[model samples]
Structure formats: C-alpha cells, structure tokens
Target: MAEEEEEKGGSKKKLFMIIGGVVALAAGGFFFMGGGEDEVMAEEMVEPEVVEGEVLDVGTMTIVLADDDPDKLRYVRVGLALVLDITADSSLVAGRVSLVQDAAITVISEMTSGELRGAVGAADARERLSTAAREIYPDGEVIRVVLTEMILQ
Candidate 1:
C-alpha cells in the first residue's frame, strides 16, 4: 500500500511538471515571436491635434447644368443624374451636402468625354473637384469627391 501511494504521488508530480513546461514554452514563444510589437507601435503613432480655428463644418451640394443643343443637353442631364446618384449614396459625403453639390458641378464642367473614360481620369477629376470645392468653401472640409454620372453623346 505504501509503494502504491508513492507511485501515485510521482505521477502527479510528473503531470504538474509537464503542464508547467507547456505554459512556459507558450509564453516564451508568444514573446519571442514579436506578436505585440505592432499593437504597441500603432498605439504610439498618435494623430496630430487640430486647433479650434482649423476645424471646418463640411456639407454637400447638388447642381444641374444643360447645354443649349438638344443632344448635348440630354447627355448633360444624364451625367448630372449619375453624379447626383453617386454623390447621394457616397459614405464619404454623408454629412457634407454642399461640398458634394459643388464638387459634382465642378467635375462635370471640367471633364471631356475622352478624359472621363481614360485611365486615372476619374481620379484626376475627383482631385480637381475636391480642390475646387475646398477653395470655394475654405470653412468646410471636403472628405471625398464622388463621380455619380458621365454622359457625353
């Protein structure tokens, strides 16, 4: 009976040691793998503070334009419609109604049919429109510029 008791005690000691080793290895691997470094660095990179005057109340706007020629006017209307739909649905212009309207008009006026279809043309248009809107309304920040429509017939 005494021998049996000693054997059980030894087994328990072995089990405990195995569990402890596994835990230590897991902890060591976690630290050695640099798993937490990214999180630490991300937390350290803070956003810059915005002074009170620098902040702007951005808004969205809509505009409609038509050419004198019937065919051209129809194309313009289609383009305008596309622009409106895109701008209205845009997540970036959710609260900026005035900016969206101004941007749509500015983009449409500046765009040629070829430019509208070319590679990187839409991006250029968005950038130009956003810049123009910002200049027009310096008090309002334009977060995004969307192309809702392009119709040139």
Candidate 2:
C-alpha cells in the first residue's frame, strides 16, 4: 500500500511538473511574440505609407480551366480588386480597368485546375495578374491584388 501511494505521489509530481513546464513555455512564447509592451513598441516604431492608395474593384470573371483530361470540364469564377497608388485624377487606374480585365482573362484562362488549387498557385496567379496589369501601365505599380472571391468548379 505504501509503495502504491508513493507511485501515485510520483505520478502526481510528474504531472504537475509537466503542466508547469507547458505553462512556462506558453508564457515565454506569448511574451516573445509581442504579447505585452513589445507589441505596442513594435507598432509605434513602424512607419506609415508615404503614397496614398486606393482600391479598384475589378469585378468578377469566369474562365474555363485548362484541363489535361478532356473528359471533365471545369471552370473558375473569381472576383478581383486592385490596390493602386492614388493619384489626383481617378483616370490614372480607372481608365485602365478594361486593360486590366483583359489581361486577367488572358492569363487566368490558361492555367489548369491543378495549377490554381493551392496557396502557392493562388499567389502565382496574383503575381501573374499583377505583372500583366503592370505591363499595361509600365510606369505605374499596382500596390496589391486582392482575390475577393474564388470559386473552382
């Protein structure tokens, strides 16, 4: 009976130590990742954007997916928006919406379902679209490309 009680006590101590270690590690991680004053300091130290930016809704587009196997037909419908550097006149980017749309359709329609399914593929698509749009306006930069809606069928 005594040995059994000792065994139980040892196990309880081990459990407590394990719990304490986990708590300590979690607390350390939280503090390390800007959980306290570090977060406020980090935010305060960052600089703000110099150039104003604006979002342009590119709207929805449906592209027939390039499929390796012809037996199945697939399509992707995505809603895209562009963040562009703000200018005095809206025509800077607004005037080129048609060009952006044409570039997007031309690029996205060429990708197979397998090429557009994962996170990497999505990022690649964004980069390609951005490049295509930039090609339209060689002097201007598209700040960011947003894929608001992505439906794969």
Candidate 3:
C-alpha cells in the first residue's frame, strides 16, 4: 500500500510539472508573438509621430533673351518651371528663382545659329543650359530647366 501511495504521489508531481511547463511555454509564445498589452503599447510608443508643414507653391517664369547678333537681334523665348523642395530647408531655397532665370538667359544667349540648327546641336544646347542652371542654384537644387518655346527670328 505504501509503494502504491508513493507511485501515485510521483504521478501527481509529474502532472504538475507538465502543467507548469505548458503554462510557461504559452506565456513565452504570447510575448514573442507581440500579443501582450505591454508589447503593443511599447510598439505604439516607439513609432515616430509625423508632423505636417506649410506648403509653398512655386511659380514658373518665362524669359526672352536677344541673340548676339546686333543687326537682326533675334530673340528666344523660354518657359521655365520651378518648384521648391518641401524636404529642403526653406531659407536656402527661397532666393534662387531669379538666379536660375538669369542663368537660363546667359546660356541661351551663348548659342550660335550653327549650334542651334542640327539635332545634336539642340541636345548640346540643352545640356549646356542645364549645367548653367545647376551652377546658379548650387544649393537650391533645380529639378528641371525646360525650354518650352525656342524661336529664333
């Protein structure tokens, strides 16, 4: 009878150990799966809050510059589009609009009749114009300099 009682007590202890192990395993799984309220709250606390800024609308400007020829005095009209980068600091980007326009004029004036005639010439002129615009707004980050209208008369 004593041996049977000892065996029953051993079984009960084994069952308790198994139950404890299962409970521990379940708790571990819940925490690892991000199921606990504390875990969810920690994630929410760590996430970055987004703040919105005021939007500034930049305008496009068109400029007409006379060619180098004194007698004919041919003029080329170019339409340029400008947009301020919201990501960039506002103070730096504010004063570059006029500089970009002036640079475009300077670039167009340098083009000769020979340079403007062929397909290669037009491409080269465009690159030169882009380079000039970039130079003017070194920090301002000019997105694009579009030559909408090119007329030589």
Candidate 4:
C-alpha cells in the first residue's frame, strides 16, 4: 500500500512538471518571436498624432437634373464645403472657385433623383463631388466632403 501511494504521488509530480514546462515554453515564444522589445516598454510606445485638415467653403450650387419623365424633371440645390489637406495650395482653390462650383453642378446633375433620396444617398453624392474636385483640380487635395442645404424639387 505504501509503494502504491508513492507511485501515485510520483505520477502527479511528473504531470505538474510537464504542464509547467509547456507554459514556460509558450510564454518564452510569445516574448521572443513577437515584437517584445519596444512593445514591452510602455514608455517607448507612441502613436501618431492626427491633425485635422483645414476646411474651405467653396460655394453653393443649383443643379438641374433631367428625369426620364418630362414632367418629373428634378433640381437639387446644395451647399458644398471642401476639406483641404494641410499641404493644399489655398490660392489655387480660391482662384478656381467658379470652376469648383461648375464641377459640383455637373456632378449633381448627373445623378438621378433615386440616387439622391436619403442620407446615405447624400453621403454618396458628397463623396462623388469630392472625387470630382480632386480630378478637376489635380493639384489640389480634398480630404473630406460635406453637402448642406440639399433640396430636391
């Protein structure tokens, strides 16, 4: 009975040692293989600061869209605002304000009433106008687009 008791205790110690060894190995791998050097030092870790872009209110536009039904032609009047990148040339945008308004009008006129119905649709239209601005003025960078006073009639 004593020998049996000793054998069971020896088996428990062996199991414990195996589990301890596996845990140590896993922790070691996580420390060594991962970017554990600078990551472990909380003081050395730093995140980049995001600077907000400068906003430039270009102007308002009244776009007339021709619907398929002659009686149902629609017009959308919207106010456009552009978020200029930090490195954008303000003079270029200021000098071409009329051109920018024309682009906005062209973009809004191309869209049908169905595409400009809801908030989501308006957001999409804003995105397209931003893209148009970038293309119309390749030298300028438009980071964000906002549409206001959007009236569908």
RMSD of each: 12.7, 12.7, 11.0, 6.6
The digit string of per-residue lDDT tens for model 1 on 28-97 reads 9998887888888988997554322222323333333444444553233322111222213334434555
Task: Tell me the deviation in Å of residue 26 in model 3.
Answer: 55
How do the predictions measure up, each by TM-score? Answer: 0.35, 0.62, 0.45, 0.61
Model 2 regions more than 4 Å off: 1-52
lDDT to native, each model: 0.52, 0.83, 0.61, 0.79
Q: Judged by TM-score, which candidate is best?
A: 2
Tens-place lDDT digits, model 4, residues 15-129: 9999999999999998888865666776567644434467778777778875677777788889988788787777666777677788887778888888898988798898888
Model 2 CA lDDT for position 41: 93
The 10-residue segment of model 2 with minimum total lDDT is: 85-94
Clashing pairs in 3: none
The full ranking of all candidates by lDDT, starting with the best, is 2, 4, 3, 1
lDDT by residue (tens digit), candidate 3, 13-128: 99999999999999999878867788678878894533333332334333334456577655554565544334455456556666766676677666666666567766776677
In terms of lDDT, the best-performing candidate is 2
Q: What is the clash count for each candidate, in the order shown?
A: 16, 0, 0, 0
Superposed Cα deviation of residue 36, candidate 1 (Å): 32
Instruction: Write one digit per residue (lDDT tens) for candidate 2, span 1-153.
Output: 999999999999999999999999999998788667877898899976747477789899998888877889889998998877665244567788888888888898899888999898899899998788778767565766778888889
Worst 10 residues of 3 by lDDT: 49-58
